[model samples]
Target: MLSDTIAAISTALGEAAISVLRVSGPQALQVAAQAFKLPPKLTPRMAHLVHAMDGEGNTFDHGLLLHFQGPASYTGEDIIEFHGHGGVLVTQRLLERLLACGARAAEPGEFTQRAFLNGKMDLTQAEAVMDLIHAQSTLALRAANEQLGGAVGRVAQAMQQEIIPVLAHIEAYIDFPEEDISPETGAALLLRLDAVLGRAQKLISTSEQGRILRHGARTVISGEPNVGKSSLLNLLLGFERAIVSPMAGTTRDTIEEIIQVHGIPLRLVDTAGLRESTDDIERVGIQRTERELERADLVIEVVDASQPPSGVHRLSLPPAVASRRILVLNKPELGIHPGWSSEPAAIPLSCVTESGIEQLRDAIRAVIATAGPLAADHPIAINARHKAAFERCAARITAARAALQSAEAPEFIALEIREALQALGDVIGQVDVEQILDVIFSTFCIGK
Candidate 1:
């Protein structure tokens, strides 16, 4: 595959200003010469207007031609791009001409796969490319960019570096079975092992937040009948996503919408009020609300602020969500009751006036932050694959520590350390990962 020239439509096939078709390989310039004329003095990366022709030398279109020399291109190969008309058929004609000239059709993610194979980036950066494209919120975008810049890879590399010296020391003692490790060497090894173990544990702790960034947080809004739940939902979304009414049980089903709070996307589910109902329809809605509550990552309990403190509706939450709940005092525009007017913990919100909306957003982000070890702005991202690798690395380090503590054979300690190094290497693709390369890159879109 690497020996063949490849061509593809690099831009989306739609009516835009222009669509880009790309060709890259050892013979990229030669393959492009069949359909487009390139001057012998053409400068690399310089744009020029060229007439496109088919196999019979018939002119079809005219556009810009640019070339990126090999070893400096996206895939570390000779690359050429055709900027042609945005019409779908026009773009397809140009791409077909290139393929007919002498270029194979690129498979999904082939461009990035080639980039990875050519040593332009590591596995984490490769995965981050898709993450950057599908990011639902700005915070997720920032996290993807950080990972793309080698955030987790740097940590894994540091751990590997710290373990190398310790491994050499342990292996030194392993060579001589009769001799035991010196006290100073033993202490030094323990210290370095602990240092690497600490980083592994810290990186593993961020796996939860990594999932949250990839997938929007599941947030559910619950309250008594007619407590402005729909009002709050609409206010958060900056539009009337849900119908607002004075009648209780107006909403007999759960309404879901995703809203970005301080750059974090929260999948807000506005549910029917939790109250005793006689109608079968209302009862079913309430049942659905209960199920939604069970799996919610964050629950917003809205209460009427015009009523006395004792009258505040308190919906019983599942034990899992007890600490992850935010109390909202809605309808405060009606007049804050004296009983709870002094309460500072609850957000005094007025959906009509939009007062305290910003504060409520801040509170939501704060509560979610408290739910996990995402204390850092850009926590080390370890997706499911990275998490498993880090877990193996940490487990091996722990085993090495245990072996040292028990004064086991030096060979046993050395073996564990080596395995730990391999596991860590897998995270950054320093070790064999051909099996997972397809799975990771398959999720990427064609033309990168």
Candidate 2:
């Protein structure tokens, strides 16, 4: 419905078999046809061989041209695509001619934004388009794909359906107090609200895992010096990403590598040995290591399996580390002994011998799976906006539940329900305007 026409180079700016120039709007075809000289038998919506020309009929490039008539294209309006030879100059000149023909350059994610504005997709699905494009792992791709397919939309819609009926029932009672509606009607409404809220809770739980998959889990491998932290990191990465040496101070700084365990991305951070140090540089490295452990979602606290039960037997973890710590008893080839049992919060392994690596991988996967799968065909909320909306909705639900528990007035519960409904609507763009739209679309790349 936008009055302006937009165009951009749709493909990545690099060498390829061909590059695409995308034009969308009411004047998309008209703008494109001005520079493209079509063949004799070619018609609209048909692919044709055309010479891309400049304003003075200077041939820029020869390419394939295809037209999509209004209302059936990606933007729900006329769209034109030019598949030209991939070259920086060629692509730029072709785009220039399109602009000279009155097409304006696209804003960041303006194409998808246009599609959203034209009712082709909602905000969640539109955002998912970007998520899918940037998904780093299989789990992330699955979650984003489900969201882009309107899985979350169906669930939200169903929840709204249930809520609307309850709201109607309550209003009916208020409208006709003489009717046979009992106070039990309020109880029934509360039950329905509970069910919907349960679903919301389940979805919220998956947000952690979805976020981990989207952003990758920060897992720090920490222990006192010479505990094979670097070796373990290399083994997990299945590559010599970290320098392994017999020297205790080989890795005096934090090193990071991305590794996938069962398709779950974990940003493995190998930090300097956690210990008291006299050297200034090593002290700074130790501080960085401590900082990494502080922010880690999961920590692998490595212990020397050869040592007896003593002060080092206890998990030497920073107070800031999360409670879910993995205790790893390294150097298992030295033999697991009674002393190993004395040490708590550990998983025994031999990084050099590759013993218990699979177990280690499974343990990481188990921790990730604890967050649970996202809702069925439900759009997993990924954007902060959607998360905020859900937060507000959750707050309203909490307030309503508290009202029910306190035997408060039914009107208060009804008000909370209305607030929850409106919050849910914002996620799907049913109740958004220019500012919210701007925030969402601004995250996208040009020609997305």
Candidate 3:
């Protein structure tokens, strides 16, 4: 059992209507009683108005005190909440009084960590708490909520269940060498392995979309000078995020902003126009633009619809970048330039008139949709850590399937299956404690 109580200001610190200070552990009620004058009987999950005081018995403030008995609270311990006026000084004083009464300050994510330790939630649900806190778009919020509701946990558990029988069969074969395993049993084992492999691959496939939802997709807008690149950025952002100019090379640096298009968050980067320039600053900006292109998830290649297609040669982009490129013919309000429109892949758009912008949005949605449609029911692994775990799990399952196909010994197949199970366990955090706990919990807010 946990020995000491932990306390923290659960709400954002500042002046507001109310601020909540949370305390949990065995000593939680005793600590709260020391600082709060309450009725003789305190009901669990019920709030009572009381005068919060300090060690000297001087009243610091008046607030609502809520008591939650152990094994039922958020941290599965005796919990107390002091809901008081939302002044920074008042909240800090209350926390200080609680600390003085023998309650230690809760660390960043300590509450949620306690929840995980006490069986109130799993590692995935604990992570979703932070994800929900940082969610930038509606889709991200929904995904986080689903994850909190055990979407990823259920999938991980299912995959783990599938691997156990395979390991059992392999172990049985190992123990009973005299009992010749028939071809039928081996074939059935292979079939079972294949099914699990397919499931793991499907889960791994959602990683990209999950990542895109968690961290907005990095999209770089590129082209020669004055192709309405800034205009496109401004139009997409719905404001003047970049300087719009008729002159060449007005934007000497990359301007980046986040916007949600079709419920997909995009980290849109408006890069310096690609062109040979003698100006030192412009050259540096262009270099940065090139670097941005290298790391971009999507490249919106803007072209001047009023100008001829020959200017495309100025970009001199790499083939890899060219592969993920979307040709956008801007200034369509002026008129579509003859040769470029005929190139079927180019999307004609007019940032000046805001026409075809919806089509451009749809195209971006299509690119994201490559990972498969975003549905509320889909279980996605929403971060690099989860994605890496899923990928490793899939790789192990694939290796096991290959070993089975090559007629490897049951021992070898079992070893591979065991490794796969370990990998899946890491996903839901059933194993591997010290490896990822710090990294995962460090991202959380202090009060959480």
Q: Which model scores highest in TM-score?
A: 3
Candidate 2 CA-lDDT value: 0.77
The C-alpha TM-scores of every prediction are 0.87, 0.86, 0.90
Error of 2 at 140 (Å): 1.1
Candidate 2 segments whose C-alpha is farther than 4 A from its true place: 40-46, 171-184, 313-315, 318-323, 334-338, 343-346, 374-383, 401-411, 431-448
RMSD of each: 7.5, 7.6, 7.6
Global lDDT of each candidate? 0.83, 0.77, 0.82
> What ranking of all candidate models by lDDT puts the best one first?
1, 3, 2
State the lDDT of candidate 2 residue by residue for 69-188, as single tens digits. 778878888888999999988998889889999999999999999888889888888988988998877777888888899877766666666566555554444544665443445568
> Considering only N, C-alpha and C atoms within 3 Å, which residue pairs clash in candidate 1?
none
Better of 1 and 2 by TM-score: 1
lDDT of 1 by residue, 173-211 (tens): 455334543323667878999999898888888787887
Kindly give the number of clashing pairs for every candidate: 0, 10, 0
Please list all clashing residue pairs in model 3, or write none if there are none.
none
lDDT (C-alpha) at residue 291 in model 2? 79
